[model samples]
Target: MQGTLKDAREVAVKKLSRGLSQGAKVFMNKAMLLSCVQHKNVVNLHGYCTASICQKGGQRMLWTP
Candidate 1:
């Protein structure tokens, strides 16, 4: 999805599927790369989040974002 920051800069937000091991691995790899790795074509990653909300059943996600 698209979003606008406080500075009025437009940006993209990506939330990958929750059920795949490959997706989780990709998320970790992206998170590991700091903004210092600069390139004209590569966009900088702003942030990410992972949450596990409890439920009566075993609905908790053991890992991944």
Candidate 2:
């Protein structure tokens, strides 16, 4: 999904798969790692949402610009 942030920057939102057996700690670790990485070719991890409840169900999402 694509949307604009509060700061008006366009970003693509990726909803992490819920089928994985991994726990929240694993996902958070990965997010932290991605957020620290810096490279022109890599899509930076702008932010993430964990254990958020939506109308559909609980979901985890990653935001990238």
Candidate 3:
């Protein structure tokens, strides 16, 4: 998905596939990879995050903010 931040900077956002996602641990890995690559003409990566919710009875809820 694409969006514009409050600063008016355009960005492209990739939604992690819930079926294949691995929460924050993996998210940080991907972000690290993105941060390591550099190119004069390529866009720079900002960061990433993982959000989740746990309910009573040990139910797990996953979501993105």
TM-score of each prediction: 0.50, 0.77, 0.56
lDDT of every predicted structure (CA atoms): 0.49, 0.79, 0.53
Tell me the deviation in Å of residue 64 in model 1.
20
- Superposed model 2: Cα runs more than 4 Å off: 51-56
**What TM-score number comes out for model 1?**
0.50
Best by TM-score: 2
lDDT of 2 at 58: 52
Runs of candidate 3 with Cα error greater than 4 angstroms are 40-42, 51-65
Model 3, backbone clash pairs (residues 3+ apart or across chains), number: 0
TM-score comparison, 1 vs 3, better candidate: 3
For residues 1-65, write the lDDT of model 1, one tens digit per residue: 67666677666765455555536566557566633456777776665544443211322222111
Q: Which candidate order results from sorting by TM-score in descending order? A: 2, 3, 1
Indicate whether candidate 1 or candidate 3 has the larger lDDT. Answer: 3
The better-scoring model by TM-score among 1 and 2 is 2
- Candidate 3: the clashing residue pairs are none
Error of 1 at 58 (Å): 13
Tens-place lDDT per residue, model 2, 1-65, is 99788899999988766666535777788889999999999999998878455312556778998
Please say which candidate is ahead in lDDT: 1 or 2: 2
